[model samples]
Structure formats: structure tokens, C-alpha cells
Target chain A: MKKLINDADDYVDEMLDGMVAAHPDAVRRLPETKVLVRSDAPVEGTVGVVSGGGSGHEPTHAGYLGEGMLDGAAAGEVFTSPTGDELAEMVRACDGGEGVLCVVKNYEGDVMNFDTAAEMAEIQGDVAVEQVVVNDDVAVEDSTYTSGRRGVCGTILVHKCAGAKAAEGADLDEVKRVAEKTIENVATMGTALTSCVTPAKGEPTFDLGEDELELGIGIHGEPGVERTGMLSADEVADRLTAAVLDDLEPSGEVATVVNGMGGTPLSELYIVQRRLSELLDEEGLDVAEAMVGDYMTSLDMRGCSITVLDLDDELRELLGRPAHTPALTV
Target chain B: MKKLINDADDYVDEMLDGMVAAHPDAVRRLPETKVLVRSDAPVEGTVGVVSGGGSGHEPTHAGYLGEGMLDGAAAGEVFTSPTGDELAEMVRACDGGEGVLCVVKNYEGDVMNFDTAAEMAEIQGDVAVEQVVVNDDVAVEDSTYTSGRRGVCGTILVHKCAGAKAAEGADLDEVKRVAEKTIENVATMGTALTSCVTPAKGEPTFDLGEDELELGIGIHGEPGVERTGMLSADEVADRLTAAVLDDLEPSGEVATVVNGMGGTPLSELYIVQRRLSELLDEEGLDVAEAMVGDYMTSLDMRGCSITVLDLDDELRELLGRPAHTPALTV
Candidate 1:
């Protein structure tokens, strides 16, 4: 394909350089590091939030690096985790008077790398570091008894809640508490209508017939929980939301987010949510806040996911706070 | 290919129905009309902002219905325009004590339908209505003695700037003025690496080889002005920006938006903007603001677009104002 890249291998670095150059008002590159931070980062006493994962999920980590989202983000190759050193540099660059909070997604490589980086940050900067592993996707089972579930679209909620808490002048521990609370309250379930093509691979991650879908595929195109026949909008919504509600049912009023997995139309997402509402209404659940769009996405998979968070007063207020980021806002 | 849609024809209507059911806090359906409006719309004396287009570009007009973006939106079939009656109902539902402004993309059906609705609103109610046609894409050209230019990604800027002005209590004429000013100052050019498949069509709009790109493609999978060999990032940026600069070069400062047409990764978009920065620097131009993301997408087409808007003081301030829409923020 005709791509605007110098070399496929150097695409991430070249793009990062341009990001710093073009959005000087928003982001700046950390000196001698692959990390991009808010232009006025390292705020004095507030807990610093850092997040990173694959590179292709644009505006996820990097685009969220602004006033009320992430402090710094270390980007890796497409669908690959950053090395320990890269993650360490990002933590060191974001550390201020308070400690740093690493919002690591529950991916094997990402978990291992961020854990190593947290140790490195303690050794290098004498900064207190804590990590919140987001495991929102209800599709995956415990890979191993030692490892937990995989994180998916629910990471965006973690970013928002943590950002709001940090913006409220919360300390590192408080920020971590809010993040963990949000994570516990949130649950997500995703399905893919079509496989996405990885640029390097030059083909879809897997083959899917025109009449089939991959239910609960991973962001990296990992096998879904199951492949099922096509469904009505209501059925799809029921399947996805049933999985989510089984994990954490919203009590009283709750916050809801319907995420599009890259290639699905917004219209379809609404249909999914429509079914979701009917299902929720049947269970007598009330929606306090709702957002539906593309927040976290697989490259070009055509599907949608649902996330519901049972909100208390604090999380509700935090969720309602104003946030200025590239991809999200309150 | 395995979509959760009931039928091809009912897809858009079902999705709209679902949107209203799910986001009761954010959207409401005009009973009998099926248009979507903010739940708290028609604020007294505030100009109403209404926009809509085809279905595939999720969150373009629909997701943007919020505090400072659009008051209402009329969704059509996938890659098709909503009928005139639908547009008229949207206008009525959003009309407040003052007036209503329709931000119509420069497509034949959209412009015609919205214009018809404006006429209907004038005769039916005390509401004042005006229309602003956005023709910002430089990809399409106006033939001699003819006015036919396609609106592309830059329409988001129009919605944002105009929505801000309307939120400030601008009347119909003033809102029209601000929208027109943005349209005149903005210019855009797009190129596609791969064609997207319309759900109903079940096939790509067009085909491209492994190394080919279609430059200047329309938002609705229309043929581009030219098809050329693949180019490097610098070359792609040069070619795209050259058209934009040729159309309207900002004097001192400009607001630049590098938008992906759905499937292009941010990694590639950054490289495109890197070259754009070098070219703008060579021209001694300053960028007042810049943004990059998938704004107005064509299904899952893999490509990016460049938009440059010459900014004056008033336009710059409006652009800088907070816009709390689903797709964008302050």
C-alpha cells in the first residue's frame, strides 16, 4: 500500500518525532528517551500517570497525554510492548515530588516490562512507584493461575478516573486507589466481525468468512472466545453485555461506555448500545453517565464492546470532571 | 463480514433507535421524525447547530451532539443522505428562542435536503434558519461556471468553530458568518491507500494494487483526481500539503489538522505531518493549532488527509474555545 513512512521499521520513531514537533503546545519528547509527555509535565506534588502498550492504537496513550489524562506515554512497535528500558525512561521522565502511577494493561509482555520499569524507576530516581493492572475484558480466562485476565477497552476508563483523581491533587496512593476502584467496577466484552491486517504482516491476523465473526478477540488479534453465526443488533448487545454484567453488575446508577473496535461504524455501535439498554432495563439498572464511540480500538476490526462501571459519588464526580485530551473528554 | 445487523436496509434506523435508547443523557429522538438531538437542546435564544451525513463515519455528526458542538443530527443510510423530512424534524427539534444554523457538508444530497428543511422551518415556526455549506476539500475542483466541491474532514472544524459561536449566543446571521469564514479559510486534500467496503455493497468501492494510492478520493468512495505510484512519507506530505497550500496559504499563523480516513495508523500520519512541518517552515508559516486523528472516515479506507485553515483573531479564538463533543474536546 502507499504509506507515508520512511521505513516500516522506523515508522514509530519518525512519527514520534513529528508528534513532538507538530503538537509542541500539547506534547514534548523526553530528553534522550522514547517517551512523550505533556508539555508542562512533572507537576509538583500530584501523582504522575504513565501508560503505554502497542503503537497503532492512536490517541490511546500518546493522544491521552494532556492536561487531564496521562503524564507520559512510552510507545512500542505495533501491538508490541516497549522494552524495560523504554518503560523505565518514561517513568523517570514523569516522576515529580509525588510518586508515579503506571497504568499497565494486562498483557504478558506489557506486564513484565512495566514491572521491570517500576523497579528501575525506584532505583534510578528514588521515586515511589505503584502499578495498577487493568484487566477489564471478561472474554479471556486466567491464562495461568499466577497471571490474571487481559485488559482491553476498559483501560480508557482507568485513564479518565485516574486523571481526574490526579487533577484533584490526589497523592500517589490516592490516585492508585481511584484507579483500582474504577478497574474493579468496570468490565468489558468485545467481538470482532472481521480480522484486522497488521501492516508488517501485510495480511489479516486471521481469516474470517463473510458469514462469521470472532467473538471476544484480543486487541492483538488473538483468538476470540468463540466464533458464532451472525446476529441481530439486540442479540449482539445481549451477548456482550451479559458477559460484562456477569462480572460486575451496576448497582443503582452507573456509568456506561460502548467502545468501537476500530472498523465498526458509529451507527452500529448505537445499535449495540440500544440492545444494551433493553438488557439493562430488564435488570432495572440505571445509567448515570454514558459515552459511546471509538476510544480504545483494535487496528481495523469491525466490532463493538460494552463496559459498565457501578459508580459511587466519588467516581461519579471524578468521571464528570473536565478532561482535555486528544481522544477523550468528560 | 459477519455483522450483527438485522438487515442491510434497516441498519441505519436500528442504529439510530439504539443511540437514543442508550444515551438518554446525551441524545433524544424527535418522536415521529427519528432525528437525534441533545436531551437538553433548544436552549433559549441560543442558535441551534445541526449537522448530518451518511452513516459509515461514526461519531462524525452524531457523536458530536453535546454542549458545544452540534445540537442535533440526522443520520442517513450508510454512505447516503437523510431525507428532507428528517432534516426538517431535526431543525424543529433543535430550534430555540433565537435561531438555528445548519452545517451541511458539500454533498449534493446533503445540501439539497438541508436546504429544503431550512425552508420548511422558516414557514412552519418562529425559528430563523440559515445554512452554511462546507466545501473545504481541495480534492474536488469547481469547473468553470459551476460550483461542485466535496466536503471532507475539514467539516469537523466548521462544526467546532460554529458550534462555539452558537454557544456564545450568536444569531443565525452571525453563526452563518463564522461558519462561512471557517469554510473559506480551510482547504483539504486526501489520498487513499486502500478502498473501504460499504456494508450493503459487500465489496470495496474500488481496488488498488499493493503499491498504489488514489490521491484526492472523495469521502463517499468517489474516484480521486489522480492515481499515482506510492511515495515516501516526505513525498506524501509534500504532495498533499502542496495542494492545500496552493488553495489557501495562511499568512502568519494557521490551524492544521492531519486526519486519517479511518484505517490509516497514527504512526503513518505523524510521518506525513513531519514532512508538512518542514514544508511549512520553509514557507515561513506558523501553526497556531494542530490536531491529528480519524475525523471523517470512509468506512475502513487506509489513508490520511491534510487540512490547513488560515486563522484570524476571531476565528483562532473560536477554534481555541472548549468544545465538548463526542469526537473532539477543548
Candidate 2:
């Protein structure tokens, strides 16, 4: 209810306009659409990478648009899926001579709409399109908006790898292969200290006691597996990491992400990161790379998520490649 | 009181450990001190740039350590200035045979401690040092923890400009001049929706009703100039910009920063940025550069600060120069 916003209906449009204004050199909005693309998108003969979802999780789809990341991203309303028409426009805008790849999260609305958009692009513009759905969240098998597992912070890892692969001039099929590989290897689990309030709702999506937390919570404020008393930072890290590692089951090396759910301070994220590093070391998992920040956030939710990616040579190399985006740069 | 931390006593140390763990390639902690230095510190012939203060402001002094930002940073307990001894050690470590420039924020404790550290470095190791104290907040003439106007988010601008000057092989005096010039031109004002709780305190530093806001709140939750009912995002932007522009009275070519106070979502910050840009355009001021994110923060506080820096040719050019740091890379 205390969010800084004007008219609730104008939230998404104003935010998109602000993003373009702040980083005009890095990203721009497509004409007459809720889609954002790289300033110089649709390169002549390379695969175009596109992804999108709801609006609350910022720096996700749009912030990842740049040279070695997404080419286009269509944003829906807060916690709502974009329409098929808007998504089709995004696909067409990002398409080069080669093809377009859609990296989607595993939500029922998102999956169906992206499928429809891909079909529309193929039928209307003769642009070949491929899709890879990310179901990396090991928190729940089914949730409020998803059928299988919910996709959480691990989706950023997919964006990194698949976008790098496409930027390396891979064909649509190869890019799809990399995206699927990333989805298969990554696992995420999250907890929420407080629920976020949508602009339209103007109240918290759910109620949590002052001293309670929701374990394995979905990004959309859906019910988690457990609601329990507060735990220490180390205990929370252990629980989240244990769940992710059990799902991932890696042997030699891995990459890790300690993503904050929007409202948590960066200092706290580093504290979680420290414990996670110690936990990984104890398990004999050599960390190939580590990222600690708010990559995919759920509005102003005060929580954190842990992600583990079982890395092979290809995924490690691809992740290490340079990427230039609004929220991420390497 | 809900924070992701271990024992409150271990908060600073663990956070520092986590930061170094998460970014080993870019930053490293001094062996026994809470000081973080660039991985390649004491660059043989370049002037060193060092800044530090309380630990709550993540990515402020420490996160700016790199080739073109800061050479070293010393951290103290939450909301407490670093000791003169630890800061002196940081100065000694960052001395690159040329000299070192210390950028101190204009809090009473920070200014006094940094002065002591500078004197200690001169008397102990004979390292040439110059200090520039930034007091850019136009909120009030004097308040708790400060002698003059409080230094808030605009300190980051001083860091960027002075750091770039130091990286470009400027001498100690030249770097000091640039830092002073930046401090003179920049003005900032902030407001808070909810108060923050320090790790040690474990309670909100201040109180606010459900529908109230504190205008011109200090970074440490000090009392602001006025407390009023909630306002829309556009109204908030208008008030903040009016205060800044009245103090700055700029003609043309300015840079702006819309900084979130940790708990505010990026979406809201962008909303503020959109309004600020519109206001600046109406004033006939060309935005040379704009940054919108949580560059400087008060731990988990739900609010934002707007900073306007009147840029000239030298400052504009230095702002555009390439710099690489953990939190900011350009």
C-alpha cells in the first residue's frame, strides 16, 4: 500500500518508459507495444533471443536485453501474463535472418501464450521459432499459476547461458539445446519473510505473522510448502541449499546464485552468500561462479532464494562469456 | 526486526566475508581488518583513492573498489564510523608510491575519524594524503550525526568522479580538486516511508503511521524536516525535484540519480526516475547522464533519495569515462 506509484493502471507503461529513459544507450521500447528490445536489435544474420513474463520481477526479461543476452522482452501486467498478440510482436521484432528463440518460465498462462505467439510468428512472417520452458524451482511440483515446478531465480542463469550461445552465432536449434540444458541443470528454492503488494490490489497478497516465514514460496505470492517460525540466516541458507542440491545432485563443480526478493538489502544477500559458499565447500562442490544480488525480484517481497546449477564445460564457458545488459554486465 | 543475519555482533564481519567470497576476482579483504581493497591495489604509479564509513551502506565504499573506481575501502560497524587506526591501515595499503586521496562523507564521526586517519598516515608512514568531505544533502542545515548538511547518496557521485580522476593518472591535488568540485555542484534530498532496523538494534529506528511519510529523512533515520500524509508518486517526485532544483538552480546539462533506500522496489525507483526526467526537461535542463538504482542505501529502509549534479565539461567527460567495480561497471 505504501508503494511509490501513480495510477495503478499506468504502472507498467511508466516503468517501461522510465527504463528506456534511464538506459537509452542499452535498451529501447518497440513501437506501439509493451515490448522492450536492444537498441540495435534484429542483427542481420544471428539468432535472436527473447523472453518475458509478469511485471513485478524486474530486471528479469527487459533488463537482460543487450548484446549477449535477450534481444526482446514483452512485459505483462503485474503478476499477469502478456497477451499472445504482444508476444508475437516481440518475436517478430527480435527476429533476424536466422530465427528466434523464446525462453519462457513454466507458468500455465506464460506457456500457452508463448506457444500461441510462436505459432503466429511462424504463420505470419515465416520466422522459425523455438521455445524452452524453465521449471527450475524445486519448491513445489504445482502452484497457483504453474502446473509443474515454478521458475524462480534460476531463470536468470538460463538467460545468461542461452543468450551467450545465441550471441555466439548458433542456429535456433543449437540455442534451444543450450536453453534446455540450462533448464535441466538448474534448481532453485525460495523463502518469504513478507508478502508483496500488487499495485492494483493495494494490499499484501498474503498475510504473514511478524515472526513467521513461508518456506518454498513461489514468486507470485502463492502458498509455500511450510509456514513456520523465523529461522536464523544460516539455518535458512542450509534449508534452501539442501533443497536445491537434493534436486540438482551435482558431483564435481557447480555455479550458485543467492538472489534477493526485491526488498532485502544487499548486505543481507551477501550474508546468505557467505553461508552458501561455506555449505558448498563442505559438500565438495567446487564453485565455478557465484552471483549474489536481486536478479529476479517479486515486487517488494522481503526474502531470498538459492539456486544451484550443475555445470559442465559448455555451461561454465558460456556463463563466463561477456554479457551487457541493464541489470547485468560482465 | 526481520533481517537476514547471524549474530548481530558477527553481522559486519560476515557481510564482509560474503562480499569477498562473492567477488574474489575484483576485491579482497585486508588480512585482519575490515578493509577491502582492489585485487590489484597499490598500482605502482597511480594515485590511490580510498573511502569508508559505516557498514550498513552496502556497495558504497567497498563495492566501488576496482581499477577505475576505488583503490581501498574500510568499513566499520553499522552506522558507526571506522576507527582511525583501521582507516590508517587502509591508507597505508592503498598508497601506490604517488599518494592517496581520501573521500569522506560529511558526518561528524566520519569527518573527524577520517581526519585523524589522514594525520596518522602522514605521521606514521609519510604517505601524501588529501581529503575532500562531501556534504551534498540539501535537506537541512545541520542534524544528528552531522555538523553541516548531511551527506547522503551524492557521495557516490563524488566517488565516481574522483575515482575516475585518480584512475586517469591525476595527481593527489588534481584528484582532490575534482572531488571538491563535485561536492560543490551536487545536491540531494530524500524521504522515508518506513524506518530501518539496524542489526544490533533489532527494531525500527523510527516510527510512521500506515498512511504517513517523512520528508527529507536522513540516511540514518534521523528526523526529517516535515512529516506528512502519503502522496502519489508524481507528487513525491515533484516535491523532491523542487527541493533539489531550488538548491542547485542549474541552467543546463545536469546528471540525476534516483536511489532507492534498500527496501523500495526497482519498479518504484524507475517511476520516480520517469517523473524526474520529465521535470528536468520542463526546466530546460539536458540530462547528460542518469542513474536509477540502489547505489546508496539505508539498511532496509523503504524510501528514495533524488540527487542532481550540475555537470560541466570536465565533470561530464569524467562521468562518461570507463570504470569497473563490483556494484557499478561502466
Candidate 1 has an fnat equal to: 0.71
Query: Which residue pairs clash within candidate 1?
Result: none
Candidate 2 versus the native: TM-score? 0.98
Error of 2 at B73 (Å): 1.3
Which residue pairs in candidate 2 have backbone atoms (N, alpha carbon, C) closer than 3 angstroms, thus clashing? Answer: none
Write the residue-wise lDDT of candidate 2 on A254-322 in tens digits.
999999999999999999999999999999989888888888899999999999999999999999999
Off by over 4 Å in 1: A1-4, A144-146, B2-4, B142-147
lDDT of 2 by residue, B102-140 (tens): 999889999899899999998998999889888988989
iRMSD values, candidates in order: 3.2, 0.8
The DockQ scores of all candidates, in the order shown, are 0.57, 0.82
Evaluate candidate 2 and give its CAPRI docking class based on DockQ. high
